[model samples]
Target chain A: MASKEKVAIIGSGLIGQSWAMIFVSAGYRVQMYDNQPEKVITAIKSIVDQLNNLESKKLLRGNLSASEQAALISGATTMSEVLQDVFWVQECVFEDVALKQKVFKHIDSMLKCDPILCSSTSFIPPSQFMGHIRHRSSALVNHPVNPPYFAPLTELVPSPWTKPEIVSRAKAILTEVGQKPIVVKKEVPGFIINRIQDAIFAEAYRLIEDDVVSVEDLDAVMSEGLGMRYAFTGPWETAHLNANGMTEYFEKYAQGIFDVQSTFKPVKKMEGPTAEKIIEAMNKKVPMETLNERRKWRDEMMIKLSQIKKSSQ
Target chain B: MASKEKVAIIGSGLIGQSWAMIFVSAGYRVQMYDNQPEKVITAIKSIVDQLNNLESKKLLRGNLSASEQAALISGATTMSEVLQDVFWVQECVFEDVALKQKVFKHIDSMLKCDPILCSSTSFIPPSQFMGHIRHRSSALVNHPVNPPYFAPLTELVPSPWTKPEIVSRAKAILTEVGQKPIVVKKEVPGFIINRIQDAIFAEAYRLIEDDVVSVEDLDAVMSEGLGMRYAFTGPWETAHLNANGMTEYFEKYAQGIFDVQSTFKPVKKMEGPTAEKIIEAMNKKVPMETLNERRKWRDEMMIKLSQIKKSSQ
Candidate 1:
């Protein structure tokens, strides 16, 4: 039998741990490293517990048993130890560009092989930090949604200097690990998901500011109406399904959509009284103390939704 | 037992039929009217078949049996028959100002009781057509999401002349029928849902136009990632959970969010090459010939998702 390939996970935080679990689920050896050895050990323990929980709930990804996947993940005290003989290196450190740049430069210096260097930064573009790296051709941004175990959409964004095969390799690896990877052809701030998200949030904030709707009701318009369909379809498919097809949908409602789009207020800083109002309203529903509990509920919901989607497909 | 309140459903189209099923499920007597008597009769049969299908799948809305709900709906040949002694009049007519005005005037001439006159126009504001009605104070817009039986969200938008109690009454009735109602404090074009939806769609279009992402991948970003969390929580709750609270969320992300929002291009006409490209991409995934089949699949997925959500809640 052939030996399994290896992947390196740097900075053993939540995202790093998730990447480790995902890679191991696909039968890859994942060596995780952190400056603080205790954090790496803790992350490995948490990953074991999470994988066990997913297994018990029958939501575990890939065909591997929990114990088999857990066995493939290990902690490394040094970056050189983790990056040795690895085909992929996922950097999951802090979101600071300077910190990331330093880490990437160090990884470039230590690596003997041209492993695919990926960062899990949600906002920072690849060009910002990868510009000075020796192996900039292999460095790219592979931004994953929070709780990648449950929501598996990763944005694979490459800098202008990054090789096309690097992006393709990253996409193949992410797909093999049971994730849906979307390629961003150009380096853009916020990439794809956050851009769409901020567009929705900005408009939502404006609605609350103008007193068109209350905070709770505004949310229901999504969770209860729009978000329900969005779980299964995108805006383009939604438009296609809502009418005869995309052409008919735009032909019928384009003017109205354009007219409403015009009414959107200029993007305002999400502060002042409106932000306070939103904070109060949101905190009232899910208090700061119970945020972790609420997040647990959300993750559980995501898992269940993923199961439902998988079964339906 | 006391008598069930009656609801007059004008225009026996798909929306009108959905309204009938919802009203009957709540034990209301529904009188459906159309200018063409055959259309009303056909709508009733379709409603019965739809109700039975929902029942067989265990996705029916209310406690009432499919037979009982079917028994409560009846066809009315004239406006007077449908309007008599009803506490609610839901106008699900064609999406035209002049046509709606004509129907409202006729409804005003026939009605004896002061029922809540609600238009199911997804786009038109109530003030556009309700301004000249005798019961203008009782008129409002109760725009429902498509396939409301499975995805039950109704937007209650009232005109300037509408009374406060009318809005409250509509809210109560909608709640009684197991629909989520979000009150639009002021009438706006496209109300709340479409405004947020267009905000998302516009940004998505820009991403495609800029060659940052493909049409298929852009949709996957939602259906796979952001939309997963959104299915269970709204933007405000999502933000609150994503951080310590909404305050911390804004404190951490406000600048980044504002920067991205400012980068958003002005909303342009969604025509020309972009529309054609989207049309081609969407049709490739879901052909026009198979649209109805795809719609059925979407509806089924919605039912499954709703069930999952209800069970989890």
Candidate 2:
């Protein structure tokens, strides 16, 4: 049934290719497009390679084989051709606001049917670009983390003008493609994930700045300590277990928590001596020159974790 | 060899039993003691069961098999008997400050040589109880996360009076036991892990209270999104990859980060409506009656994650 539905992925970047794979994995006919056709061709090749890799690892999302999923993806010569009969559109262009606004405006004029217009913007909210679009009611942000196959979260943040049913449709589509979608009711800068990340980074920076712990020690505290629990559960659930339950947890530690939180230093800009010091330390473990190697290592771990999560369930 | 060393673990609760398991796995003789001899016997039983379980999962640390590790652990009726000829001691008592002070004073007076008096206190800093101890120089906080066998990170936090050599020795012992030990140079409340945990929890509470996202959706952002990378890398390494490098990351997004961080609401007491609301949501997923079920699920995931980490490397 999903094979009868058509979706278009604009920009043909890493995110676009990943989205194409996701849609195709769910048996959707995916039309890939880029302003420069050469980029789209490159995306197609990378998508095939990625699908083959996912297949070898047995981490592919759907029942379809790699080649079968690859067969459902096709490159579009023109933007109009990409939007021809698509039920949904995923725009993965550059992060610049003006560029997104221009491309979205163009797509809005070209769009015939009211398909869910989703932007793969991690930081930018939909309100930044959807104001001038004709189909503004359908526009929203469907942000996916990097390596979306392993990190399957999709944050669904709709603009003020976005229709409620459109958000629901986007959520259902993402879920259908094996992506976990979290709805951000109102538009917030950084949305949910980045907000939580920045919160952690803020405290991490403070720890380093105050010399409470070294960079290596700080990371170890997470990867070996907190990250172990977080891999399977979240903060609230962790709190629930740490004490008898959430209510008991508050009864025992709320005052102490408030006291500790009060001492948390003000957020500093992520520059100056502190930032340089952290960069220096990070370089020692995963040097800037060998980042890609480290990233490949990270992705391999993620794949294994995905498999572990599946089997444990 | 580490096999020649003997360690005493006072108060044979879960943490003490776990510490004994860690020490025994490293080929050390562990003498477990508790106020009630029955609790010590129960701990010995639980340790055997846990070691057997770890062996079944192929997660038993060190070169020892399940029964071999179990043989290295024994229950002691008397505190002096537990401490006799021991090279180190891990005091795992109730979190009450006065009770800890009394225990430390007793342990301090009973010390034959200067065995490292490592307290397994998570929140109470060593200073709170170590000031009056005769062998205060050897005292510090060697805090371990729950289920220390799988989540092997230990925070080595030294009191102001603690000798530098004691810190190094405690770190070495923890390392020998296959634990990832990170130094907390200065004593701070909540140490490193809890401080970071509280920071995350503070923001999580605010997000929930403000209704930015539902409890379930907020957790999905971590378990599915940020956690995927965090399971392998820390925040600093994550920042390094999100942009060109750490320096480039700061150059690009530091200001925006400061802006968002500034907007973070003030820390409030974690009680009243917010706490109840979170409990309500958490109970829906993991009911209070089934906490043991949820905790088992968490531990199983942790074991699998540990396996994945080892295999990925």
Candidate 3:
């Protein structure tokens, strides 16, 4: 009756399609636009396929049936059509800063009313493009991990000029669509997830570079060891549960922990022989020729894991 | 038919009990000894309860039933009895360097042969205690995570004097019992897992202490974001799959990554108000009073995740 609270999704790429599905699955009316009109039809087909796949696996989010949700996603013929009465626009263009700047400028000129402008860039900060825009106060980055349906975290990062209320609204919208949104308070490079990821990767590279452990065994140290706990609990909760409490944990292992932390080497530039060796080993396990198959396996496992996490909670 | 391999489990606490269950579940005759005999009986009861729980969940690792495995674990009247005819000994005394040294010294004197002597310590390096022992060549640390049944990673850390062959054999034995063993090539403090854990924890502490994110959101960045991928793929494989390969990943994001890593603050000591804030927040989610309940929930989720991981593979 309230016209389903329209959302405009620009760029019809993988991320754009995912945003559309998420909005529609939550009963929002979604209008998708692509610079090239033909691509929108292809995106719709892929979205349908993905929705059906999730439905078959019973992993579809929200209460809407696959066809019903798919029916809610429609392509817009013009930027004006896409922005028509929509409360938000999700930009999912290529990660290059110049192209993103141009697209945001265009969107700013076309919009009739102020709408929440969210970018799906994982690297480029909002400050680069949003500072000169009329709707700069509403622009922020909603960086999602790949395959948003399975891994539901969206890192909500706001430009310095962005309104605080818009950040809260974005998180609430993501929550309605069954996404877990975390805020990055200041504009930090890599935001929260990738910054942590780079930290782990730097250490992992050093271990392999030093030949302390082979690449395979090094992987097991995480997938089989630390990952088991981290998959459910974060580092803080882990410390709490590992001992009586945080204070007890520090009392027991603080000095030893410090000693180990000091042993970590400086960040190695990821290149040359070490990178080649890692790539070769990874290819042996998941050959470059069939990388997609391995990714399929990874996604299937992630879906199953997501289900387990939800039920357990 | 070959005889069941015997393993001596000294100090029947939680870690010791887990080691016993794992050994007996693999059809090994497990001889368990504790400083106080009454504690062994209590441990056997808890072990029985754990095995039954695993069995009911259909998550039991080996062919043996809960009772069948429980029947294979017996209390030793003395250290000599526990060491008699045992091919290996897992020392699980309190996590004190001196206490562990004392226990290893007693086991060394009573052993029938130069058995593979491993300590179940999460922190203390084997080099500290094993250096002065008579049978130091066979001594190492076989660190198991808490509730070893669900999280089966065992870090095999060898002292300078530890025999290379013994390390290999220790790995083989752990593998036989369905435990994933990673060899720490050198005796490093905290070994591989804890070192990486400390790195992540240090970053997490800084992020929380700096007010970049709330304690809850920081944990969400891990459990909901990076953790979903890390659960199955390690950092290496993740980078490989993220791009065409590891080389491409580095080519694109290495500079950006280095910039972010350089921004991370020095490790904050886990004391004072920051520690208290984290503890209070954690307690609110999983009350310290019902810590065990939260732990049980964690274990159940882990078991389910393990099953999914195995089947997906």
Candidate 4:
């Protein structure tokens, strides 16, 4: 553990703080950088709160004392200082195009060694910021699921210009740090995860927009039915193991899938009737009077489920 | 346990056997009917093996002895015999349209009371078979995940003609049997699970079909990345809880989702080049050389995962 690599996290909001907690727990010396000194000063406290929550729930894998947690974090005054001598830099700055462009370009300019510079932006591609840069080889998008402190699903989306060696390095580092890092070989608009999410929301919006079912029913369809299976087997594996194998599954049902595909008509921006439908149903399910309480219930369920999953492992 | 219900399972193939195992383990009397005398004679033995496997794996919530298991199964030779005093009837016939039509019609005609008549058919809806029948109000689809002995996901899709009371009854019975069921308010093609699955597959096909990434990387993206998060949270809850609150989440990122949705193109059918891409990629990732071995691994994983999930409850 003394040979732990140094990791840098740029940004001090929820995403960056979460990264700090995870890296520290995974036995990495984490260097955190944020423009606001106040948030940086309290980052260790925030990390402690998260770790305590994990401990109370018996979800903390990397046993760490409060002082030990503090020892791993070094909040730097400058981004350049944070990147200095670190093996990897995970940038969780703002998701704005120009902001990422300015911040990443500066980090790229100051890099003496090309440590993997991964952006935490969910939507934009790496090429959006790294495209015309000099040391763009090390810059790529490494999007993590929100509250990635508990959920370890992290996507390493490499741009077309991203070097294969950098991708491998990023994958190996993330694996070492208790994160499930899957690579998106090609950078689609939202990458693979969000692309699949968009596909799901299209149906959800369409169903609610068309008045086919309630929002609660739509959620239950997944949570009770498909979501449970999905927790273990993916869509492909589910199909492959359904009847015969995947081949026989396609042979019997490919035409059926295409026929269903033909019927899918995506709803427009959830602004007017679609938004009203969701809000109306949500109001009924979780009224504005008790929305805050309902939100806590949701998060608690997520935490409990997270705890259950950890025990399973 | 003494007030437990009875569910008649007609047809003793894989689906039927799975149902028998599910019902018996959930403290229900199961009358299994198959035209083949050999199948009816051996259905109890096979179900015992399945239950024993589940018991050893810690997936069975309730235990039944061999004598008790045999007592739970009151084998019936004909449809009328099986349905004599059954509270629910789940038909898992072959996938022929004509055969399903004929069998469903007879079953609907013989159903004396308003007990639920649920079919485990995938593509075909209740309307296709029971639209003109006398007991159409009690008939609907209750499609379960394959090997329902383990995976408990069931889609309780209702036809337009189906009565509310029947749907409620089916849902309650499903719950007692320890199978998770979601009601599809409308009988849409592909139902809820498969429709969303097709949408994801369509985009995934386009992604791979367009050479965005190879098959293995894409599968890894779901298996290791997004699918892990989805195991715990639905898309709506995910969006709502990702940020501090739901409003902040939607206000922050709905535009990005909308932007991606706006540019999504329609997918071509899986034929020719598109089909070739998937086959080539799947072959490369999960070669036919180790297909049998991989299947064993998947089953073992399913056993472990199901055991873990059941224990947490």
Tens digit per residue, CA lDDT, model 1, A1-313: 2338889999988899889888988899989999999998899999999999989988788888999999998988888898899999999999898999899999999999988999999999888999897899999999998878888999998998999988898898899788999999997888998999999989999999999999999989888988898888998998999888999998988888889899888999899999999999998989888988888888888888888788877
For candidate 4 chain A, the 10 contiguous residues with the lowest summed lDDT are: A295-304
Stretches off by above 4 angstroms in model 4 are A1-3, A63-69, A280-313, B1-5, B63-70, B109-114, B273-277, B280-313
Pairwise lDDT winner, candidates 3 and 4: 3
The clash number for model 1 is 0
Which regions of candidate 3 fall more than 4 Å away from where they truly are? A1-3, B1-3
Q: How does residue A247 of candidate 1 score in lDDT?
A: 91
TM-score of chain A in every predicted structure = 0.97, 0.96, 0.96, 0.90
Chain B TM-score per candidate, please. Answer: 0.97, 0.96, 0.97, 0.89
State each model's CA lDDT, in order. Answer: 0.90, 0.86, 0.85, 0.73
Label model 4 with its docking quality class: acceptable
- Tens digit of per-residue lDDT, candidate 4, span B18-110: 787778766788888887868877877777775666556655545665446556877887878887877888888897778878887787777
Assess every candidate by TM-score: 0.98, 0.97, 0.96, 0.90
- The deviation in Å at residue B35 for candidate 3 is 1.3
DockQ of each: 0.84, 0.77, 0.70, 0.41
Which regions of candidate 1 fall more than 4 Å away from where they truly are?
A: A1-3, B1-3
Docking class for candidate 2: medium
Predictions ranked by lDDT, top down? Answer: 1, 2, 3, 4
RMSD to the hidden true structure, all candidates: 1.4, 1.6, 1.9, 3.2
What are the clashing pairs of model 2? none
Relative to the real complex, the DockQ score for model 2 comes to 0.77
Model 2 ranges with Cα > 4 A deviation: none
Better of 2 and 4 by DockQ: 2
lDDT per residue as tens, model 1, B1-313: 2338999999998889889988888899999999999999899999999999989988787788899889898988888889989999999989999999999999998889999999998888888899998999999999998877768899999999999999998999899888999999998878998899999988998999888899999999889988888888888888888777899999999999999999999998899998889999998999889999988888988888888878877
